[model samples]
Target chain A: MLGDALSLSLGYNATLVTLGATLLGAAAGMAGTFLYLRKNALISDAISHATLPGLGIAFLIAVAFGWDGRQLAILLGGSALSAALGLYFVNWLTRETRLTQDTAIGCILSVSFAFGVVLFTIIQVLPAGRKAGLESFLLGSTAGMLYSDALLILVLSIITALVLVVFLRPIKLVTFDASYSETLGISVRRVDFIILTLTLAVTVLGMKIVGLILIVALLIIPAVSARFWSEKTDIILITSTAFGALSGYIGSAISAVSAGLPTGPIIVLCAFGFFLISFLFAPKRGVLAVALKHYQFQKTVHLTQGLLSLALRQSIYEPKTRRLLQRFGYIRADGVVTEVGKSLAAKTLLNEKRWSYWQETLRESDQFDGQVVFSLMDIETKLTQDQILLIDQGLAARKGKKL
Target chain B: MMSGIALVSDKGVLLNAAADDRNAPFTIRGLTVSYGQVPAVYSIDFTAPAGSLIGILGPNGAGKSTLLKAAMGIVPVVSGQVSFFGKPLKEARYQVAYVPQRASVDWDFPATVYDVVLMGLYPILGLLRRVSKADKAKVAESLAKVGMQDFADRQIGQLSGGQQQRVFLARALTQRADVFLLDEPFSGVDAATETAIISVLKILQLEGKTVIAVHHDLSTVSTYFDHLFLLNRKAVAYGSVTKVFTKDNLVTAYGGKLGAAQLDAIGL
Candidate 1:
């Protein structure tokens, strides 16, 4: 059943809803990259929450005109207007007052959302709003979505994604360095407006599938998850968009196969799954990779110290060091140093001595400042044979002087 | 003492001439910048000669950096006129390059050294234009100029503080402007980076470009800059290092921050 639903054999409305949700996810992911990079992720929450009042007002207007109040286009337009207003309010509060951006966002988010809840309650009490299905805007219900509604969402998502792609360079430049961008003649204000517009578009379009509350998850989670996987902006962008689309696709399909699951929370859960995976297992920056790197470094330190002890004819007291030395065949199970152990230990000691001597000699020169630290790396890799021989000769001369 | 007086009179004559040169590299008149109600830079007037290395020096909170930012039009000036090559800043912005302090931007931004340097060409590229071979060559040349060719593909944050500063300098060099404004370019940098940056600045000066830097090290003022503008919320002194870098001038600009012993240490 799940396979059929995923393959789009789940009938017409289900397929349209699934495709629309996927496009919305992709668009949100792309636009959210700039928002994330700008460190304004919380603003999207304010914008999305602020959309509820618009949704309620649009329904009222449609009902007053005796038209179907659940019209997706009219409701989306209303949400976009309110979201833009909320964004303006946040900016004004931040610029005109002493309130920080996050404080402004919190202010707008709570007040506007509370007003929206009141509107929702008012609409629920009206006879015309009895079957309005406005509750879907809270957690999103795609079960009874119209064909035209799905198409509208898909089309808007495509447009938003395309716009984001076209303006990605300027947006990235401004976000990374606003002062530099100004000197480059790129208007920081205009780029910021474009980002906010794209963010507004994504939020309004995402409301029908992901709901107002969970849309921020669609906007932030994918971008953040993608960050763990790459150090390149474009790669992170692509990864984020892919993650969003996959979450939307699987979440919508699951909702289609199961009657009771809400699409928004399911999609958000799916995005969270990606974040969890990236957090634990992505290479270089991931938790697991960092832990593994730390473990390898620790093992190297133990093995080197154990070998050095062997070279000095000392006993290994630490159990972990002894086990590591034995595993590497540097020591016998009886805590005795093997032939291999002595030679390796001697080389380690020599490398340590060579590094110290090199540091002392170059104390006045910063030529090898950050790289000359004593590590398990071979000295031959860091210095030429002639340099090593010179150091060795110097060491011999020092010993001769001591004698 | 007589020769010192003669040098001051000579510099005074030069300053007067430069004020009306019209073709001066940079000229600021009655410049005042404020943050909210508090003034940071107040009523400062200065002009730079062609092909000269100038230093803007002051103690902490003395508005040395504020002066640069206001001159570059990055920060709004309360009242002033900043002209570049006899034209307004907007008209001649392309001829001016600015290197903001390294701490002003996030180094962890996702970009390679090459990518950041390539941004120098963004104004010329405009929208819908691809970076051509010549532009790429220019970026490569700038990186090579700063001895950062090996770090072209490395992430920006992976570099040391000095390397990061070098990368910013390379970005500014790619602008190929007639005047360079640097804010604390040598601060927190290693000796090698300082040497590399000073050499590059000297080369720029030799090529007839005006290099104006906000400098902190009073000891290197005479060695690095041919001209100095001493500012402490106002223009304290402005002239050649030998003429203006005096005990009285240091005390005036620093305002009790520089003691007699400290002034003696810098040979003021």
Candidate 2:
């Protein structure tokens, strides 16, 4: 198994393709961090989809000059041009037309994608268009990548990463708060334009590796997954880039081993896998960790309530209640209620009584719903019938009457 | 003498610093701000003294925040000029700090209190320069001032509203600016946090920093500020608290609905 893995990695074309994909992933992920934090993650999708027409038009222009239309530089330039135009269009629509940002992005995304589809159809029937091999970009065919294609991707990725490092401070501030950054003497518009241009560059270069349709996954998945692991922006940026590179390398390798599978879908699937793992397993922010903390909180609330009830009934906790409270660290081994336990009981009782009073008051006004109260509490344990009845009586007696 | 420090003229005067060396610490001339042609702050003029706490008191929708934003150049001005230390905003940037409203930022953003505080050092460090050990030490010192040294590494989202306000105050302190403009700093803060912030503001005032805040609670205005700017789209009154915090000023600012008893009851 070791030999097989080594041989697969050492294959000349496989190594180049994987290296190129990995670089593209890291670059996209770095740029994606700013976009994600600024709440504009979908802007990448809009830009990527917008690049399709650029690729088609570039091919047509190259063919008109009797040159190979698939030249890497020319194609990527066209993609970048159209992506910039799409960005400007979205900006204009949102600013000048009173359309919401989501609406602007959606309009550009759908319109540009549909126009590209039309251009693709038109290219197919042209005399030399049948040989353009532009279809490979739709669902990236990594096997078709020449050494120069991989080299182009590698160069762009290096440039992008360098730019990000040089401008890290301003980018960090702008992402956190643009208006506040302005007060620090930073030009918010200039920083925003720089970030958008960098994102466009990454998206244009990434289209060949992940395909325009799925490149957004490479951008957003890693950034969001990184959020589950760290709370610092620098740490999140580094972790996200690492996750992106890992996804690219592993996804490309898997596709290389399996014939007839496309690289783009495999890469996106790999990113999705990482996101799922982070969502479920990451500490502090993950689903499982939050569920555990919530469960512990509920149990503490129950134990505190039980202690309060016992204290009220007999001026002491019942033996069973005391043992439960002790096990939960609400009481000391000497059978005395600890300070923390006493405060917890008092706090819980206060909140319960407050909510009960509100419920009773609302009921007298013909506006109460027990289910609404339960749902608002949002606890897993159902309140027994007797407990509800007791709250009702307590609330009524507090109102100068008994139920 | 600090090369960039603005000096107050002896005549309680606002000088054009290019002609005379003495400069007012903060001044706004004919400042008007609007949202898409609808005016928010209209033709306001004021010259604030150095080393004083000023409260911007106004009713809701009175453009208190808009004035602050316009001063910071965050919002576009219809026609106005804002000067700090007798210089343009960009030139005086390092000497001035603006603490935005607490609700303006996403607390869930992936940053710890320390990380946010360190952002104060960015403008001083300028572009492409990494923060040094000295910067980190300064951040810790600022956190200590706000009684939040123990929470330096805590994620900002986990903090209570008052704790979050303290963290922001610490961030502003880290900037070490001579002038501060805070927007609604005490709106949602607990009494303890409010007192703590007020004490810190007092210390800054003692150190000769000009602090202006958008304040909502009329009851605390007299104790919090030495001067007051009562505003409603226009400057209704601007002077020392003792002279400006009057029943007539309150009525004008609140559209003539507030009574003298109401002002007296609030300790005005």
Candidate 3:
């Protein structure tokens, strides 16, 4: 795999494939960043859908001249033209009509996708169309490359990506807050226009490998995943680029092994896999991390509440007994409960304090409540002298007429 | 007050007196703006001698913010011009600074306070320009001036509303510009943060840098304002507070259609 990639990146086939994939990846990533940020993720979806008409139109034009539409000029020109028209329609639907942005995008996205499918079918139906080069155009076979097609895709993606990198700050600012960017002497509308144009440009270029069906995912997932790993825009951009490159290479390789598999969907799926891992496992923003953190916080609170209740149950539970509550949550080291061993003991019943802690935990947890409130669940669960006091106080607080 | 820039009143009651000094500043003229077809501002014109502090006063939706945006070339003006030290906005862009309303943005943006302030240098730095030692020094100084030096690298979204406003002020300070346009700089800010921002604005004013602010609160109008533009879709009044901020002028600005029948026109 390694030698194959190097031979590809350095050799004509490899270099062309890698260069095309990487360039397309970067454009997708860059354009996707703005689209994601501006709450216009669906706009890319709309553009992708809308590109079909252009593909159909380009193919129709190609057939009239007895040429294959998969030629870079026809395929990309068709996609770009359709996408551009989709954007214009999007703007028009939003500005001229009473339709909102998403609604307009939806209307255009479905219509264009339908039109593209119709065009693909029409091209296939031609008497000599069996060899019309439709498979490469539809599924994106990066391995079977004619040099010029890859070169055009590379040039277009590079120019678009460079523009994104150059206008990074203003675009990021406008995406985050247009009104704020404007007052800072930056042109909000200009930045907005730049982002929209770049989105269209990158989408058109990426349609070769990333393809219409899965382009938005390739563009969005990498950045979304990278966001969990970094906060600074520079770091986010760098991380996103790295992820984009990795997914692009992996998707291409997968397609090389699987006969007739579409490279664009696979690439998108690869990027999405990375996102799923990041979403579920990342330390900072992952779902499991939040759940575990919440669990630990509750454990600490339960221990503290149990001890305070134990103290309140008796005018003063004996110092040794007073210390019992702490021991249930921790080891009684140096006359104070050490901040250790709480997790294991919460699962046990060593003493009254420990028992009380267990009962409170059960009552607070969904296991005991059947989805009821912790306070109400406390009424159903039995506990020690200390546990009752804690639950009563907690319930009192919940009622808002506090003790 | 982002829009309520500091200045001395007629009685020499120094408003936001901690400014650096009055210096070179931009001149906004004939600025007109409209959102689609509905007019937000029109024939808006004004100037501030290099170091003077001016406040833009108006009731809600009076186009005070629009005036500042037009001056910055952010808003598409139907017709008008803005000059900084007699130069167009693009030519002298780096010489001006803008602080937008704190409420106008979603502070949950994924950026640190340091990065927010660093954006002020973007014009001079350009895209892909690294922050040098000098740039770092400027960011540090701006943060310190707003009493947020320690929080420089902290995430902007984590800060309180007041702290976010301070971070924005620190960003404006980083510009080190001759003119500052702030919109509602003091809204949602605690007293200390308000005073701290005012002190910085005062220092800028004293240093001969002109500051124009869009202010909402009338109570602080006379206190911090040196020059005033009392607006209601058009220039109702412009000049010293005593000359323009009077009952009759305010009545002319907002008290229109007071009749019971006219109340219906204004939605009561």
Highest DockQ scorer: 1
List candidate 3 stretches off by more than 4 Å: A1-23, A92-99, A128-130, A133-143, A147-161, A177-198, A298-403, B1-31, B243-268
Estimate the overall C-alpha local distance difference test score of candidate 1: 0.86
lDDT of 2 by residue, A1-403 (tens): 3234224555788878788888888887888888898888998888998898999999999989999897878988898899899999999998888799999999999999999999999999998889877877777767767888788878877887888888888888888878889999888788888788888888887777788888888999999999899888889899889889888888887877777778888888888888999999999899999999898766655575576664454454456656678887777988667777777666666556646555555333212211134323522144555655666677667777532
Worst 10 residues of 1 chain B by lDDT: B1-10
Better lDDT candidate (1, 3) = 1
Candidate 2: stretches off by over 4 Å: A1-7, A312-403, B1-22, B128-130, B256-261
DockQ of each: 0.47, 0.34, 0.23
Model 3, B173-247: lDDT tens digits are 887877788988888776767777778888888886778888866667777877777888998877777676666
Candidate 3 docking band: acceptable
CA lDDT, candidate 1, residue A385: 91
For every model shown, what is its TM-score relative to the native structure?
0.93, 0.84, 0.75
* lDDT, candidate 3, at A270: 81
Q: Order candidates by lDDT, high to low.
A: 1, 2, 3
Tens digits of lDDT, candidate 2, B1-268: 2322444333223232233332667888899998777899999987767777889999999999999999999998999889887788988888888888998989999888998888888888887776789999999999988888888888888887887888888988989999999999998977767888999999998898889999999898888998899999998988778878888789889975666777779866
Question: Hey, what RMSD does candidate 1 come out at?
Answer: 3.9
> Which number leads on lDDT?
1
- Per-residue lDDT for A123-153 in model 1, tens only? 9999988899898888877877778877777
Pick by DockQ: 2 or 3, better one: 2
Predicted candidate 3 versus true structure: per-residue lDDT over A1-403, tens digit per residue: 5456634644566566666776677667767766766767778778777777787787778877978655777777778877888888898999878899988988888888777777778778877566666545554566566678677767766776788878888987787768666656678768877877777776776766766677777778888987777667777777777777778877766665556777788778888888988889988678898899887666655654444443333233345544545556454535443444444333232334443444555343212222222322233244566766665565546568643
Interface RMS deviation of candidate 1 = 2.2
User: Rank order by TM-score, top first?
Assistant: 1, 2, 3
